[model samples]
Target chain A: MDYFLELLIGGLTRGSIYALIALGYTMVYGIIELINFAHGEIYMIGAFTALIVAGVLAMSGMSGLSVLILASVVAVIYSAAYGFTVEKVAYKPLRHASRLSPLISAIGMSIFLQNYVLVAQTSDFLPFPNLLPDLPFLANYVGFIGSTEFIIIGTTAVIMVLLTLLIKFTRMGKAMRATAQDRNMAMLVGVNVNRVISNTFIIGSALAAIGGVLIASHVGRINFYIGFLAGIKAFTAAVLGGIGSIPGAVLGALVLGCTESFATGYVSSDYEDVFAFVLLIVILIIKPSGLLGHKPTQKV
Target chain B: MSTLNYTKYMEGMKQAVVVSLWFMFLTFPIMVIRVNTIENIIEWRWMNMLYIGAGSFILSFVWRKMSGRGISARKESIGAQGGRKFYLQRLVSEKRLSLPALGIVAVIALFFPFVSSIYQTNIMTTALMYVVLGLGLNIVVGQAGLLNLGYVAFYAAGAYTYALLYHHFGVGFWLALPLGALAATVLGVLLALPVLRLQGDYLAIVTLGFGEITRLVLENWNEFSYGPSGISGIPRPGLFGMEMDMHEATVYLYFLMILLCIITIFVVNRLQDSRIGRALLALREDEIACQAMGINKTMVKLTAFALGSTWAGLVGVIFAAKTTFVNPASFTFLESAMILSIVVLGGTGSIIGIIIGALLLILLPEYLRAFGDYRMLLFGIIMVIMMIFRPQGIVTGVRKTYEFHTEEK
Candidate 1:
């Protein structure tokens, strides 16, 4: 039971990070129908930004809650900028080109971003300062669950709830939904589809930034290449959840997280990535529309 | 007239501004770095960033003048004008300089090893391998219009097949080459079978996943693969019964590559006119219409996958033999991207185009090695710029005209 609980907690915490990143993927995919391959790089940049911020703050003799909030805010802003630029420069031009062109362009952008970071930052892994505050009183109640785990879960829940509310109620969300449903119809309805797309990129990137900060702090290290694997895994999570569905992304991420956790715990960790991919293939084979996605209505 | 000229200048200025802003955003992250000096100072090159922006703006202005229209206009002209003389085709058809050009190229290939240093010959050898890989990928991406993002998987499959066969089963390189290619083809067919229903982006993702899975399997199957340390000391393919030095070996490989290239081009060109090829072309244009016309979609797609993977596998064996090593690291997503870029950059479906594309993409980075770390950075940037500026590729493939077949019809 203890082992199971530990696995479950670990899975949930990891799942929350994947869920945050997956939401960015699902949202962008939902709106533009382009896999923003550079989004992973965006998360990576966010972590780097936070690392820089935390380093600067620490040198100035600041730490704990204030430093975390400030670093996260800066990281979010930087990531949002990157997201906006990537969409405009890379994706927007090829929106109507052959299907493969945008994808190729996205991959190019991803490579460019990766190399950009490699040139700018050290290739070696740099330790990230743990920003989660330790509160001793809650230790008894939440036994094996670390403060970092709680923070990650809490942050994800709060963000997911807020995002749900925004999507369900806000005008921007309505415009996004409308644009996603049909770009032409959305245009007719006077939704600035370009603006909506840009906003989607910004919001999605900000969310991914949060994931980056949390995962970096949790792992206690950051590197230039962390984004690539995490991005692929999160993308798998998004696809497993049904690419365009938000709730499905979260659900898929949790499932992916648990599977990865169990695979690592029971089986050899080397095969963990293989298990996720196999799961993806099996799911895609069985349900092409994914667990929550609707069967796409084909028009003659 | 004066006002119009002024308006044009203003428009050009506006474009420059926009381009400058774009560059600023793009290079923001790259221009700043944390130097690990005594104080850990943040290195931010404001002047360098601004200069790059200005340089890009000026380059765009120059490009606008050279191209003689807006960028969109260039794209429209290509789409609208189908009969524009493709240089290679026109030269060959006109029977003027093309045959001699071909002779010169062949002569150059024949004598290149002796004239250039061993290092240069080695580079050309690697470039030739890419040429073969590029041609194979062109059949799938260019001919069939299928986006395969995991092409390196087949390459890996081929490489590993040869390596395993040699290491365990004691197969000769000559015999193993065909078997390795066959293995890749089989794997390709198997991969396509599972995702038969997928289309477009979904198909792309599935292939990407499969590629990652293959890599992971290779890496993790330590009992077989030797786990990341990689298998080394595989015997090099011999020429006749001679034990050759490095230079002779490279030259031998070059000639072999040329023969393989000739075979691939001849077969692909012949296939281009075949019933199956036309069916594939039809499928690429419209899957539904092709299916309605009684074409077997699954069979056509599977054949495409098979043919493409076969070439990749052949090259894989060649690569493994040349390097005498095999590892999962060599077969990353980036390798697939490089191959795809070659196909896309060289006009898709064009044989000569693939040659040029493979040469430029492969050799450009080698030549740019002087730039050190910026070589790959430039590669990525060039790829994006190429896609944006020339989606049709450097040598836009001439649309096929079925002269002989049409006469019979």
Candidate 2:
């Protein structure tokens, strides 16, 4: 029972990170019907930004929650700027072309970013020691599950709450919803579509970066290619959650994380990939719109 | 004859001269450089000889036709002679005969053992393997309009299947090959089950995830797959009953590779004209229309996934046999991209076109061996330029029509 609980917690933590990234994919896809293939790379850039800011903070010798808070602010701002720039440069120009053009371009940007980082940082994995603790309270149950699980799940819950509040209650949130529903109507009604997209990129990227930091902190190591798979998982999470649906993304992330963790833990780990991919493909075939998404009927 | 007929004769003649000249040049260098063993120059050898022979045959035909010409301008001759026939003859321009030209090439390929060095043969073998990969992807991206971003997953699955079976179970390549294909097909079906509901961008993302997820699992799963160290020393393909290690028979092996290439070419060509291909194209153009017209889009999609993946799996088995190694790195996104590029550049849905595409794309970089680090930069620039100039591709609508006419015939 304790082991199961641990696995569940572990799953939730990973799911949280996935949920954050999934939100970006789902939102961009929801509005423009284009998969922002570069989204994962943006998450990558954010994680690196966090690394830099955290390094600066530690070097300056700031201590306690203040250090964490200050580092967090800088990381978020940096990642948001990075995300906005990525969209502006890669996506905005090809908006009028067929949907496939933007997708191809996004993939191109993704490849470019990965190679750029690999060239700049080298292809080796770097160790990132604990900027955040695993916390002792989780230790008593560590035998049952693990410390990483607690930190991830806890951070995720806090972030989710904040995100929910931001999306549901805020004026900007209302405007964002208005924009997603109908871009033309939103524009005519004086809601800035481009601004909303920029804002969406910022929020989504910040969440992914935070998730990235958590992942780095949990694992204590990362490489330039870190976001490649993680980004895909988060995208899966968004799809699982029914994309455009915020709660759905979180739900989807949790499911994917749990399913993968359990599969690794119990089933043949060698075929873990075979299982997850096959599962995703199966789900898409069965429910094309996704579990959380409503299918739109086509007009003749 | 009318003006058009006269022009045609003239154009045919010009092509004949040009083709024969090209063929002569191909052989002229050979005759001049016959000092060292024929294998000395690395690049010029039996392949060039075959090119010259084929070129000569085509050139002779053109020469014969042009000899009949009264007057000619290049453009007018092309119009008179028939553009397709001119291009076809012009393309070979060596032997000046179709069946005999082919026969000469075959005889040369057979005698390659007596001539060329081993390195050129190895490159030919590699190019043939890629021809299969290119054709498989064309089925998915070209026929079905489904963007399969993670095709390498199937390739890996196929390779690993061969390695595990042949190494551990003591299965022969023949048996292991089909089994690997089956496993990939099953996996393809399984993958299709989820993402079939998704279309366009959503489908692309899901497929991409599927690809990465497969690779990640393989990477992290240390025990069975040996983790990152990878599975090595897999078995090689064999002669009918003889072992490949018995002799330094590069030419015989090259012959076998050519046989496989021919079989692949034939199979893809047949599939391209079948009812299934038509259904796939219908789905590509308009999914709703296909559905309304009584096509079961689900089944068609699954068939695409299964067949396309099956080919990849088969190619994977061949790859495993050739390399004697299987690992996660070999089946990366770049492999998928290369295959996708081949399909796109070949003009999608074109069987022979993809062959040319694969041969050119893969061999182009090989020939530019001097460029080294700058190769990728140049390759990328070329791709961008190709897209800008000939986005419809080199072989676009030809195959579709070819399939129909063959059926009619």
Task: Give the CAPRI class of candidate 2.
Answer: incorrect
For B1-409, candidate 1 gives per-residue lDDT tens digits of 9999999999988888888787776556546546342365656667767777888799668756644654656766768874555465576455677788899999999889889998898889899999999988888888888888899999998899899989898787899899989999999999999988877767878898999888888898999888787888888889677999877888888888889988998899998889989988998989889999999999999999999999999999999998999999999888888898898878788788889989999999999999888888888888887777777777767776756554564
Clashing pairs in 1: none
Q: Which digits, one per residue and each the tens of the lDDT, describe model 2 over residues B1-409?
A: 6999889777777766666565454233322222121222212245555655566758467435443341243346447754443344344343455567678757976776556667777777777778888888888888889999889889988988988887678887788889989989998998888667778757776777777777777787776576677888776776677645523545555666678778877887788778998899899989989999999999999999999999889888888877778888887876787787777776677775687778887888788778754455456545543443344555543533433344554
**Candidate 1, A202-276: lDDT as tens digits:** 999999999999999899988888999899889999999899999999998999999989989988888989989
In candidate 2, residue A159 scores what lDDT? Answer: 85
* Cα error, candidate 1, residue B107 (Å): 2.2
